[model samples]
Target: MTDRVLYLVVCGAPLAKRVGDGVRAARESGWSPYLIPTDAALPWLETQDLEGAPVLTANRKPGAPKRAPVADAVAVVPTTFNTLNAWANGNAGTYPLTTLCAALGARTPTVAVPFAKHDLAGHPAWLASLAVLRYAGVRVVNPHDGSSTALAPVASGTGEEVAKRFQWSWVLNQLQEAGA
Candidate 1:
């Protein structure tokens, strides 16, 4: 895993606030994690600071980034419901989505840590999207239930319980298991 480049892409979700710790945890686990935040997730970095990781996003142009490392595997942490659905339906409309879609095309191993409200969780479309992503080889990690949907909030509160319950460990562990 040390030689592999692990990409940690963030979507807008409550758990995203504490992802810097997850970044450090990933480093401790021997993975080189690059942080990629979705356009909606961009504001997260303004209030949160993540050290020692190179952050990347698409330039909206049709070429590979000059400085971006090719992803050996990807973990879309705290993936929002909309992002999850769009990604499943082949919507590479955002920078994060475009990058992830490319990685999927190249057969790079990918994982997703989803976070959604209870109401959203019950939607048929959301469930189907989870299935689509899983069928496409993305290991959808369901922190709430062992079942598919693959979403779980750390705690009922905001992002405070992340250290105790966010399942950052699970994400990194799966990345390792993916040979990331």
Candidate 2:
């Protein structure tokens, strides 16, 4: 296994369909990536190869051994409106949320690529949540590029088109620069 461990957390969004590409890219970059998909993301993952990376959907049973190695970094690709708001509000209602909250609490080097549409991004809570996460040391990158600048919301009915051109390198570069 690689010395670098990455928790590749995925949410249900059009971008999720390309998650296998992310996993392969992580491996190619020498990171041992583990998949942590929200329940909504399951359908998209059905066809992903995962490159043998372990998929952790739920917490281990009490007293059970750990599911994967400690994460050296985290990449929350396709961070949906629901997941973003919930995580920023510190809601650990789901396993993915619990993982995100714990990572924040531990100050793990984290990156989030929001994939919400313009309509959802118009909500006050959307920007507020991104601000909260940024204040807490998470690197919020634009889904279109790796820029740390303010993200532009995806246009309606164009999520799949956006996903098609999304590059895994954007997220990987952020983690590398973070020294993860």
Which has the greatest TM-score? Answer: 2
- Could you say which candidate leads in lDDT? 2
Residue 55, candidate 1: how far off, in angstroms? 1.6
TM-score of each: 0.84, 0.97
lDDT of 1 by residue, 33-150 (tens): 8888987777876666587687886664567446666878898987888988888888988778887788778879898877776677778888899888878888877655433443
What does candidate 1 score in Cα RMSD to the true structure? 2.9
Worst lDDT window (10 residues) for model 1?
145-154
- In order, candidate lDDTs are 0.76, 0.91
Cα miss at 119, model 1 (Å)? Answer: 1.3
Candidate 2's displacement at residue 62, Å, is 1.3
**C-alpha RMSD by candidate, in order:** 2.9, 1.0
lDDT of 1 at 36: 89
lDDT of predicted model 1: 0.76
lDDT of 2 by residue, 1-180 (tens): 567999989999999999999988998899988999999999999987877878999978999999887889999998999999999999999989999999999999999999998999999999899999999999988887667877989999988988998998989888877788
Candidate 1 accuracy as TM-score: 0.84
